[model samples]
Target: MTPTRRGPKKIDYVGAQSDGTKLAADLPAAVQVPDDAVAWTAVLGESTVRNLHSPDWKTREHALQAVMRSLGNARWNAERSPEDVWNTVTQLLDKALKDKVAPLYYASLELLSTLVATYSPNLPYGVLTQGLEPLMPTLLHRVGNNNARIQETSIQALLTLANQPALGLAFLAPHALSAIPKKSQSGAAAAIQMSGRLELITCMLNVQVQQQMGFGTAGRTPAAAAAAGKGGDALMAEDVVRFTRPALDMPDDKVRTAAVRLVAEVYRTRKAAGQPFEVEKMVGAGLKPALMQRLA
Candidate 1:
């Protein structure tokens, strides 16, 4: 027994071949975006865009909604052409806007937001400007929808649109002066509460990043620095007065928490910069106490 010692066999993972031939470990996957029309046609047909718009078959409507929801994951690979993908998405969005079914419409908006997140910024602005703008009022109405999920999805769509500065300003400019009066419905309140928190946090971080980078300085090498400064200034000036103040006083704890965090971040940034910590001036009107409590 002492004389018998068997050593472990060394397995070469890299060198191991499936057959007699050498394996190409780094080879790309075989399935790719086809240049031909067949693949896209199949995707279009399978997406049930037409069926979702049909007035008949309630079950088809539901099924189409689910398919639209899942469409976000279908094009994960970079094989599809941007034009083809955008066309398909725009078609789906068009049908969704026309559909009387609320679920289908919500799913479509969710897919649109996913497209914004996943795709390059070079996507046709016409789609957003022409197609989406007309739908904004309807979408805003849906933000107070009875269904919590629908309302949330609508908020997400708005936030996604807001990522594009031109689109954001266009959409907001009209409504910025108008009051975003609280909805009578509880579901709408819940949705606004959730979405407002997310928007506030994003805005705060954006301003902080701009401030850290010294955005407006002439010595900055990147042209984007000056643009960032201008953008940050605009966001703080507009949002602090409009969105942030309202959010700070929201009835929901989550909304208040996010508003507080934003106020605290702004206060800290200004303090560090030797700028006046004018909490009252920043928050405006009635939110000083809540903002102060959060900062403390």
Candidate 2:
């Protein structure tokens, strides 16, 4: 009788290799996939939380995926208190955001973006604010990460969180205002990082501008009375202009260009919102020359 033939064994899960080289594989199909009704408690199990901080990058990446998948699939409830879950997830993600590995960093940002998108509408404002307070600073710092993908992901994550009612100008403005790099501190690499930070701040301000003008995600213009009723602390145009003033003087063209874009966006946002503050006047005579030099 001919010997029975068998194919190579399939990997249902990733395991450590003998040579210590990381395996480039996705989590196995056998892994439990969370359904639409999965609870946060089940997803944030002990082992899963532990793996999120594992020494192995792949393990951490897989843990991020599990968390993200659960959030994406789970049914969120505004009435259900999410403090415990929020704290646990926030702590893990904070570490993950600081992860040196590029893939893990991006994954962390994706997970964060998912969490904010899923729960912002349902969760209480104070609860979300409490959870994200520590995170916002870390995120602002990560916006300057060396990896381009990480920078972009970090920016997107910040905007996703900020655009929601739970987090707006009141929460984000201070962090953005403080993240500017000193001219002496920014070297060749730092210049690029500075540009990333400027870009992110510009995007965030633009989101606020859109909302203030009643051009929200739905893009329906509300009545004048209702437009002013959109509650939250409006971002001070003067503060942002002052924040970017240093960037206007930086010798690096990229940094200067980003700064110019930021200032321009600030002016445009004010114009669109019909805000009373004169941003150009706020920056004094220097604003025009800076704009002209760049335009020239």
Candidate 3:
């Protein structure tokens, strides 16, 4: 009888080869790649970054997929070093986020959100500090990006960045909004924009209270639990009183409700923590006046 034919051994297969020299043979003849591909990250990472910037959407999609997969692989610890990943991909992300192609921009933002969620503590100090701190001004500028999808995406990115406490407080401080002068009038085109911003800030205040209460996966520093880092302690109220005026004065119903909820959440958390709070007084003093001003 003739000898039975047998399938090729698994070792002979070249797909996603664990070793390099063998895989190299499978690449197209005209495609040039580095010889030391066993160093997977070095070989594919640069190419992946390049593909993200390529004009073709297919190329960008494949590159983003490759990056997503690499971020999950144990052998790819290089991506965990946030500084290195930032250096490799920052320019590409900035361009892609601004790309006319919606998918490209959305995917780019997803990558950043992933970086923040997965690599928070490990992210490079200088990169996180230098890169993220300047984000609010940039985001405020881009608040009018292509449309609501991009605007919402920008807000999500900002929230993700705020997973870092210091970064979060940097933007939430009243000083951050001090630049936008208070607008008491309505019917101006800016009213619509103003409403959206007030709603966003209200969301932030609630989140800060949640984070401080340990209801979140992470939280801000203890100083966040108090109101003062200044003076002889007369004005240190353990809450941001100055900003309450703007939140209450916001003409939007949702904005006022959010502002009340913010105050309520702070009251709830402080009570739980055994810290003193004057909910009635703050409401009477700040909210009542602003409500009257809003109606009148």
Candidate 1 vs 2: which has more lDDT = 2
- Top-scoring candidate (lDDT): 2
Of the pair 1 and 3, which is ahead by TM-score? 3
Clashes of each: 0, 0, 1
TM for candidate 1 is 0.48
* Superior candidate under TM-score, 2 versus 3: 2
lDDT of 2 at 246: 73
Candidate 1 versus truth, CA RMSD in Å, comes to 16.9
Q: What is the C-alpha lDDT of each candidate?
A: 0.49, 0.62, 0.49
Structural similarity to truth (TM-score) of each candidate: 0.48, 0.70, 0.56
The regions of model 2 sitting more than 4 angstroms off are 1-43, 72-81, 181-184, 217-233, 272-280, 285-296
Q: Which 10 consecutive residues of model 3 have the lowest summed lDDT? A: 8-17
TM-score of 3: 0.56
Residue-level lDDT tens digits of model 1 in 157-256? 7656654533443243343223444443255455453454445345434534563575422212232223233343334433544555666666777667
Q: Sort every candidate by TM-score, greatest first.
A: 2, 3, 1
In model 2, the Cα lDDT at residue 181 comes to: 40
Kindly indicate the candidate among 1 and 2 with the higher TM-score: 2
lDDT of the structure predicted as candidate 2? 0.62
Best by TM-score: 2
Residues 1-296 of candidate 2 have per-residue lDDT tens digits of 99998532211111212111122123343333223213434537756754654556688789889878766553633333466556657766655665656677677778887777776666665676677876776676667766676678778877776665555555566677774544425577567657777887788777766776666642111321133243353456777777778777778887888887877777666666677545456666664564655433
